[model samples]
Target: MAAANYFESKCFLFFLLASLVVDGIVAAAAVPKQQRLDRISSLPGQPPVAFSQFSGYVTVDETHGRALFYWLIEATSVAEKKPLVLWLNGGPGCSSVAYGASEEIGPFRINKTGSSLYLNKYSWNTEANILFLESPSGVGFSYTNTSSDLKDSGDNRTAQDALIFLIRWMSRFPAYKHREFYIAGESYAGHYVPQLAKKIHYYNKAHSNPIINLRGFMVGNAVTDNYYDSIGTVTYWWSHSMISDKTYKSIMKDCNFTEEKSSARCDDAVSYAINHEFGDIDQYSIYTPSCLALTNGSRQHMRVKNALLHRRVSGYDPCTENYAERYYNRPDVQKAMHANTTGIPYKWTACSDVLIKNWKDSENSMLPIYKELIAAGQRIWVFSGDTDSVVPVTATRFSLGHLNLHIKTPWYPWYSGNQVGGWTEVYEGLTFATVRGAGHEVPLYQPRRAFIIFRSFLKGEKLPKSKRISLQLSFN
Candidate 1:
C-alpha cells in the first residue's frame, strides 16, 4: 500500500522538521517500580498483571510515502483468550505515547523525575492486549521528509493509513491476527477510531475474510455527533452548576450549536459557567476533581507546568487539571501534534480546535454505521464518564437518542466496591454504560469500574447488577 498524498506539502514538510529531545531524563533506579507493584498486589480483588513487551517500526506506503515510528506496549494475556485493543489519542496529530502510554491504560508510567517506569495499579492491560501507536508520519517520533505529507492527513486518508499500519503490524504479531480486534481511543479519535473500524468492516466484507475480526469498541467521552456535542457542553455546564441557568438558557437559545462557526456566546457560556461554579478559579482541576486531588500539586510534577501542558516532546496529556489553559495556550505542543490550527477561531482550552476544524458538515448522521454493524451481528458498546463536559453523557445520549435503540433491558446502576457508580442497559447486542464521578478518560478516572465493564464485555455477560439497586430499569 502506497502512502496517499492527501495533505502533504514542502512547506508543511518543513513544519515537520521539529525534532524531539528527551527532557529531564532521570536515572532508572530512582523510579519506584516496587512501590507500585507492592501496592498493586495488595489491592483487593485486583487482577493479576502480566505483559509481553514489543517495540518496532511499521512502514506503510501512504501519502505517496513510507510512514515509520516506534510501536510499544504489551499484548493481551495468552491464558485469558481476550481481545486485542489498538488504542490511539486524538490530536489528529498527537502522540499516543504521551497520553495513551503514560497517562492512561498502558502498563508503565514515566515517574515524576522523567526516568524509570512505575506500574499503574489500574492499567487497562489487565483486560486485553493493548497497542499504542504514534501516527500520521510526523506526530511525535514518527517522521517524514516530504512536507506535503502534512497536507494529506484528512479523516479518510488517516483511516486508510491506519488500516495499512494494522495489516503490516499484524504480520509482526501474527498471534493477534485471529484475536477479536477493537479500535478504541479518545478526543479527535472519536472520529479516528469509528472511521477506521468502519473501514476494517468494509474491507472484511469485500475480501470475504475476517482479517479484522472486530468485536466491539468503546469511546470514553468521545466526540461523535457535532451538534449534540456542542449543545451538550452548555447543558453540562449548567447541570454542574458551573453556569447560571439564565446564562445557559440564553446561550442555548442564541448559540447555533452547530460545529460550523465558532461563536462568542458559546465561548462566553462556558467561561461564565466556569467562573460561577468553583472558588479559587485559577487552580481548579479540569478533569474530575478526584484525579487532580491525588496529584497533590497544581503541576503533575514541578517540571510539569500544568496538567494540560502541551510541549513538542513532553506530549499530549488529557487535562485532569488546568484543562482551560492546556487546550488553548500550548503553542509548541499544538504545532508538533500536527493540529489543523486553521480550524480554530478563538482561544479554547478543551474543544476549541475541533470546533474550528474542517469537519464534515453532512446531514447524514453516524447511526448508519451503527445500524450496519448491528445488522451484521457485531456487538457494540458505547460508554461514557458522566462527569466529562467535553463529550458529556448528555451528548452521547443525544447522539444515541437519534438511533432510538429499542430497550432490551431497562437502565440500572452497575457496581464496583459495593457502590453504584455506573448505569448500564442492554439493547439488542449493544450495551451502554455511564460511569459516575468519571470524566473524559474513563479508565484513568475509574479503572475498577472500567474493569467490571470490560469483564462483562469479553464474556458476553449482561451488565453487572448493583446490590443496593434493582438490576432493571423501570421504563414505565
Candidate 2:
C-alpha cells in the first residue's frame, strides 16, 4: 500500500509540471506578436516609403475599458538594431500624434491642405524606432468606456497608466522588449516623462528581471516648475521687449511667482500682461508671426486662432493643425490605422480641452524628481528653444540653478556641421542645451539642429563643440 502511494505521488508531480508548462504556452500564445502590427500598406496621399508604420489602441485598464492610442514608426535604416524611443507631448492632455508626430519629430508632416502628407527630412525615426503615445485616456483617439476616468485623470494616474501601457506594449511587440529604450517629450512632458521614469525605476528594482530596458529621458521647452516657468516667461517677455517696463514692474510687484496657485491680484496682473500688454502675438514663440488668416467660422474659432498662432515660426504652416484635424477625423484614415474601433463621441483634436480643463493634479515643481532620477544614475537632458517665451530658457536656467549640481563641463557652443547649433552645459548628472532660432517646438523650427542634439543625446555623447567659434559665446 505504501509503495502504491509513493507511485501515485510521483505521477501527480509529473502531471502538475506538465500542466504548468502548458499554461505558460497558452499565456505566451495569447499575445500574438504579428497580429498587433498596424501594417500600413499606404497612407492616403502619402509618398511611398520603405519603412513600416503601425498605429492602434493598447488597452491598459480592462475593467475601466481604458485604451491609449499609439503610432510606432520603424527606423529608416537598420530598424532591428536601433533603440526604441517613446515620445509624449504635454498640455497634460495633448495628442502626441498630432503635435509630436505630425508637426514635430515624427517621420511625416501633414500638408497645409489637410489632404496629404510630406516627409520631414530630419525625422527622429531615422535615428531610432519612434513610438508616439496618446496617454491618460480621453486624449486624442485614446478613450475610456467609463466617463469618470476622464474626470479623475491626474499626474499619478497618468504615470501608472503609462507604466502599464509600456509593459503591455512590449508584450505585443516583443522585439522591443529587451531593446534599449528612452522616453522623450516636450512642455508638460517634463512632468510625465520623469514621473513615469521614476515608476519604471522602482519597478526595475523590485523585479528579478526588468521589463523595460530604460536608459534615460529628455524634455524640451518643458514646464519644470510653475514658479520658475511663470517668472521666466514674464522675464523673457520684458527682456525681449514684448512687455512694457511698466507691465513688467507690475508683474514683478503684484505677482507671487514662487507659488503654484497664484493670488487673485497675480492672476489679474498676468491676464493684463498677456491679453492687454502682449496683444495678439503668440505667447509661445514671441518672434513668430501670428496666424491671422484662420477664419474657421466656428464657436471655438478664436481659441483655434490663438492656438494655431503658436506654431513653429521659422517655416510656420498656419494650416497644419487644421490639416491634422481633418485627416484624423476621416473614416478612411481611422479604418486604415485600425483606430476609433468603438466609435468615440468627439472629433479628434490636436489638444483636448476636456482633459486640460479636467486635469486633477499637477506638481508645483519637478526639481525634486529630477534630483532623484539624477541620483539613480539615469541620463537626463533638458533642452530649450531660445525663442519660446512661454517656458523660456531663462526659466529652465533658473530651475536648474535650484538643483545646484556641480558643473561637469562649463557652458560651450555646440555645433551642427560647420555652423553653431546651440549652447550646451553639462552638470554632474544632467545636460542642458538651447536650440538657437527654435521656438517651443524645437524640431518644428530647427529640424537639422534638433536632429543633431537628439542623435547626440541617444549616443550618450556631448553636443559637438564648434571648432572655429570661441567658447566665450556660452552663457554664464
Provide the global lDDT of candidate 1 against the true structure.
Answer: 0.58
lDDT by residue (tens digit), candidate 2, 377-431: 9999999999887778998998888899999999988876667788999999999
User: Model 1, stretches more than 4 Å misplaced?
Assistant: 1-50, 66-72, 263-365, 467-476
TM for every model, in the order presented, reads 0.70, 0.87
Error of 2 at 230 (Å): 1.9
lDDT of 1 by residue, 1-476 (tens): 12445345654665655321122234333334422221212111223545555444566874455564433445445633767888887655656666676566776555443323457766667667777776655655455555566555556767777898888777655557767887778766777777777888888878865667888666666666767666665666677766667887877776775545547766565455545554322221234223322333332310000012221111123332233234314564334333333333344222222212333322224566777777777767778888665567877787777777789999887777577869988887578889876666676667667766666666677666854332232110
Regions more than 4 Å wrong, model 2: 1-37, 295-315, 467-476
**Candidate 2 overall Cα lDDT vs. reference?**
0.82
- What does candidate 2 score on TM? 0.87
Q: Relative to the true structure, how large is the alpha-carbon lDDT of every model?
A: 0.58, 0.82
Tell me the lDDT of model 2 at 203. Answer: 90
Separate clash counts for every candidate: 23, 0
lDDT of 2 at 220: 98
